[model samples]
Target: MADVRKHMIFHGRVQGVGFRYTAKYLARSMNLTGWVKNEYDGTVVMEVQGREAMIFELMKGLNRNQFIQIDWIDTEEKETETESSFEVKY
Candidate 1:
């Protein structure tokens, strides 16, 4: 199956925290491919692409815990791509 990509923007106190690192770990463990970066406006933006079920699982897992303060999770479907593995943005 082709990889489905999603552009996600996480709002709230997401910066200066370990949200990015944790997200990277989660994505890696889930075997998803994408990049996660912190926005200047204290928002965390990410481009995640992977299997449908794994993607949904990762998103749900992210929403479950209270590690990061998630005010809102705005996501949009994007174009598909061939992703090798997940990673964290510098």
Candidate 2:
């Protein structure tokens, strides 16, 4: 499958709940490359590049976190970027 990139912003009780860390870990485990960070508007933003299935799995993992409540996610498909590994960005 062709690699895909997604620019996503997750809303609702995402900050201060280890969302970024969980995403980073899940991405690494799935061999996806990208970065995740907290936004000033109480949302979490991530740019992930990998197989479409892996990306979906990453989102599923994030959604399953007990402490994280994801009301919705805004996703946009974008051009892929070169990245070596997943990262939690400030």
The estimated TM-scores of all candidates read: 0.86, 0.97
How much lDDT does candidate 1 score? 0.85
Candidate 1: residue 8 Cα off by (Å): 0.5
Task: Report the C-alpha displacement of residue 57, candidate 1, in angstroms.
Answer: 1.6
Candidate 2 pairs with clashing backbones: none
Name the regions of candidate 2 deviating beyond 4 angstroms: none
- Per-residue lDDT of model 2, residues 1-90, tens digit only: 899999999999999999999999999999999999998999999999999999989989988999999999999999998879999988
Candidates' lDDT values, in order? 0.85, 0.94
Candidate 1, residues 6-36, lDDT tens digits: the string is 9999998778778888778889998888999
Structure candidate 1, residue pairs in collision: none
Local error of candidate 1 at residue 30 (angstroms): 1.1
The model with the greatest lDDT is 2
Candidate 1 residue runs with Cα over 4 Å from true position:
none
